[model samples]
Target: ADMPGISKDRLNVKVEGDTLTIEGDAEIPMPEGMEPLYADVRATHYQRSFTLSSEMDTEKVEASLKHGVLTLHIPKREEHKPRKIEVQVD
Candidate 1:
């Protein structure tokens, strides 16, 4: 979810079964007449994945990108959420 300086056009997300995958690539263009001898920034490509649990509601999962930051939301299903069981004594 910490996808800073990444654009939506360069981002790819996929979920299969219980696995979630995220991939992206970024390349900054340089001027033809200007070149830096010492540069710490360069083109980058990344891939990450995580195994989701059965409690996650994959159908309702959502994602949003803002200010180069990506956020993913995976809420627990109603049936999977913790609930207080009622006590009845006969």
Candidate 2:
């Protein structure tokens, strides 16, 4: 079952050694009520975070949120970037 509220592609991750940091937020409307409920909606802010992989590159990470959707683009370092190496023998 998929409960759709907000979705993030990468969530903007940065890996520093063994520490990974993720920062983002979501904007949800308060319940429809004329009067104050149990609690005010002012404190209904949204935020989320996560710990990333140790191999992630922190310097090339990017994140953005628009229209309630979040996008994260994490680019690894050249050394960490995935590629095939060819060897030549003469």
Q: For candidate 2, give the lDDT of residue 24.
A: 36
User: TM-scores for all candidates?
Assistant: 0.79, 0.48
- Name the 10 consecutive residues with the lowest summed lDDT in model 2: 1-10
Model 2, 1-90: lDDT tens digits are 111244464234455565655543333545677645464334333444466665666677776656555567766567766798899999
Q: TM-score for model 1?
A: 0.79
Q: How does candidate 2 fare on TM-score?
A: 0.48
Which runs in model 1 stand beyond 4 Å of their true positions?
84-90
Q: Cα RMSDs of all predictions?
A: 2.2, 6.6
lDDT to native, each model: 0.83, 0.53
* Predicted structure with the largest lDDT when compared to the true one: 1
